[model samples]
Target: MNIVLFEPEIPYNTGNIGRTCVATNTKLHLIEPLGFSLDQKEIKRAGLDYWPKLNYEVYKSFDDFMEKNNHPKVWMATTKAHKVYSDVTYGSDDYIMFGPESRGIPEEILVDHEEECVRIPMFEDTRSINLCNSAAIVLFEALRQNHFEGLNLSGELHKLHWND
Candidate 1:
């Protein structure tokens, strides 16, 4: 799975997302004009030991990203979408894009790709979910649909054997 953050602001959030990407073996794309530098201590701290293992790229602009990535299919994550995220059939190379923390993806962009926009179901009174959490929810669902390709299905206990 590929997770794209456009103009991400918070280093902590990006770091956490980076860790998640590493755990899932997913690629992460970060658009430029980021609020924090990748070298910031907060990023390494939040990403923990997994920071170095994260597979990610930084793009100069949206057009640069689109061109370099060959205009791959992208699913926009937004609160304004009428489509439920789980309803879409995600391909292995599809990208899930999230907007800046302050405001979401530009309304114009969402309008242009309205069909590709999707949203997570939430309480009517609630405003939104945390960026990191939202990304995890949709990403895991996509992974689940693909039967968690390239992922460890189960784990073993540290002090005891599974057969024990």
Candidate 2:
């Protein structure tokens, strides 16, 4: 699985998402014109020691990304979409692209690929959800659909209480 962030601004959110990517064995992609530096302390602080473990890439532009990757199935997450994320089935190598914290993917791109767009179910009153949280929601759903093929899972439960 892959997570692509277009013009992400918040280092903390990016770091959290990066950590999530490492934990889930998903690849991360960041488009150019980022709001913060990758070396910023906040990113490392949020990502902790797992920063080095994250598999990611930086693209100069969206067109450059599309040119290089050319992935067969790319799902763009946006608030303007009609399809619920859970409605679609995801493949292991499918690319899931997200927009920046402030504006999301470009409207032109979204309009061009409207059919491939998805959205998380939320109350009608709310404008949107957190970027990292939204990514987790959709990414995990895909993982679940695939029975967590490459992900680690443990059947053993760590009991929080002893016999009382």
Q: State candidate 2's TM-score.
A: 0.93
Off by over 4 Å in 2: 158-164
**lDDT for predicted candidate 2 compared with the true structure:** 0.92
RMSD of 2: 1.9
lDDT of each: 0.94, 0.92
RMSD vs true structure, all candidates = 2.5, 1.9
Candidate with the greatest lDDT versus the true structure: 1
Give each model a TM-score.
0.94, 0.93
lDDT of 2 by residue, 1-164 (tens): 99999999999999999999999999999999899999999999989999999999999999889988974577999988999999998988898999999988899888888889999888878878999999999999989988999777777877876766
Positional deviation of residue 78's Cα in model 1 after best superposition, in angstroms: 0.2
Q: How displaced is residue 140 in candidate 2, in Å?
A: 0.3
